[model samples]
Target: MTAQVKYDDVEVGTEIPAQTYQIDRMNLVMYAGASGDFNPIHWRENFARKVGLPDVIAHGMYTMAQGGRFVTDWVGDPGAVLDYGVRFSAPVVVPDEGGAALEISGKVEQKLDDNRVVVALTARSSEQKVLTRAKAVVRLA
Candidate 1:
């Protein structure tokens, strides 16, 4: 694990190292079992298309969790996250052949009083659509 990022060391526009995640049908099925979100759109291609989706998509929360992991991993502790939220801008379409890949990146957006910083995040799938627009308030040591 990386050492904690001190509040004094961060500044607006500081970029966190980006991470890439791959999601396949099996992973989505596992997530469904683990999260108890059996929404057909996440696993059944026909159901997804019937619901207006191009293909079976990964769960929004699963994508959000990956984004959260990016921040927590960078900060070295999950407790450093004071607050986090995301707007699901688009679905992550997982192809049956090669699956889907998501690239997530974060930037320090602002510095706040009392050892806090705001991190802005952007997640994009292979299709180039913004999958998640997320922001988090992190308490630095």
Candidate 2:
């Protein structure tokens, strides 16, 4: 699917709108079941603290997906993204009562040939940077 966002219409250093996602323990449980990565650090608070974490944490890949969603939603086509990656810098600590919030924002870092642009992403949870070196290469209409 071609992106509704046109490459010619975009500019380097353009800011994509930001988004915030509410992440709860149930979301982690569902992610674990879907990914088969039921590591206790994600769902078991006691085990997470035992492992030196503040509390139950969200999966790294799950957090990455949220960043991807932020980019794709902006361009208006998931298939428009040719490449995406992130380095996990911190954990999204999910508390028992209110859970956690993942805030994501992006900017167009570079405009490339072939209708592609490099999108730089930032992901934060609990006022902490959760993902670093996050970027996406997207082909636009």
Candidate 3:
């Protein structure tokens, strides 16, 4: 689908609506199955703790995908995204009880040529920054 947002209407510093995604053990298991990243640290608390982690943690790529979802949902087209990248900073610790909450937000950082804009994103979980240097380049309609 084509992007719903127009390049002419966008400005640097325009805010993308924030989104919060719930990540639980079941979700991690499903992600592991789908991604083939069953490294145990993502699904087994014992293994995670044995490896020096506080608890079972969400996959880094899963967290990055949430950031991607935030950008695409705002720009209104997944294909509009030309480039996306992030550095994993902290883990999203999932306890046995309630799921963890991953909060994602972004803003247009630069308006580039060719209807493209650079977006700076922030991802946080459990009051700790989870992803650093998260950014996406998107082409608007």
Candidate 4:
């Protein structure tokens, strides 16, 4: 855990520190089991190829969760998040060997009433394609 972010200390254009998340086949498998989303496109390479995917792709929700992690870690408490949403803009291609790395970043876009802030987030893979277009509303102390 980290220190709570005081509401008065943040500005609309302030950028939150970025973080990287590594995703591999094992991670996808584990997420599939945990989330009960056993879509073969997320695991079986042959199915992915048959479906015209470049390779076994990471689950969209998994990538979104990683982006959520970045924000939750920054805000110090998951309970501080009031609302969060994202659109899966691109598929995260998970290679068999090197896997894929996601770099996620956030910025305060607006300050609402009652010490709330709207955060805009961007998540990209190594190929520079945006994977998740996310935004969240957080309540600050």
Tens digit per residue, CA lDDT, model 1, 29-61: 999999999999998999999989999999989
TM-scores vs. true structure, each candidate: 0.93, 0.96, 0.96, 0.96
Q: lDDT tens string, model 4, 5-124?
A: 989999999999888898999999999999999999999999999999999999988988897788789989899999999988889999899999999989999999999999999899
- How far is each candidate from the true structure, as Cα RMSD in Å? 1.3, 1.6, 1.4, 1.1
Q: What's the lDDT for residue 26 in model 2?
A: 95
lDDT of 3 by residue, 17-117 (tens): 78899999999999999999999999888999999999999999999999988888888888899999999999999997998999999999999999999
Candidates 1 and 3 compared: the better one by lDDT is 3
Candidate 1, residue 118: the lDDT equals 94
The lDDT for every candidate, in the order shown, is 0.90, 0.92, 0.93, 0.90
Clashing pairs in 4: none
Return the TM-score for candidate 1, rounded to 2 decimals.
0.93
Model 3, 73: alpha-carbon shift in Å? Answer: 0.8
Full ranking by lDDT: 3, 2, 4, 1
lDDT, residue 137, model 1: 95
Name the candidate, 1 or 2, with the larger TM-score value. Answer: 2
Residues 51-140 of candidate 2: C-alpha lDDT, one tens digit per residue: 899899999999999998888888999889999999999999999899999999999999999999999999998789999999999998
The TM-score between candidate 4 and the true structure equals 0.96
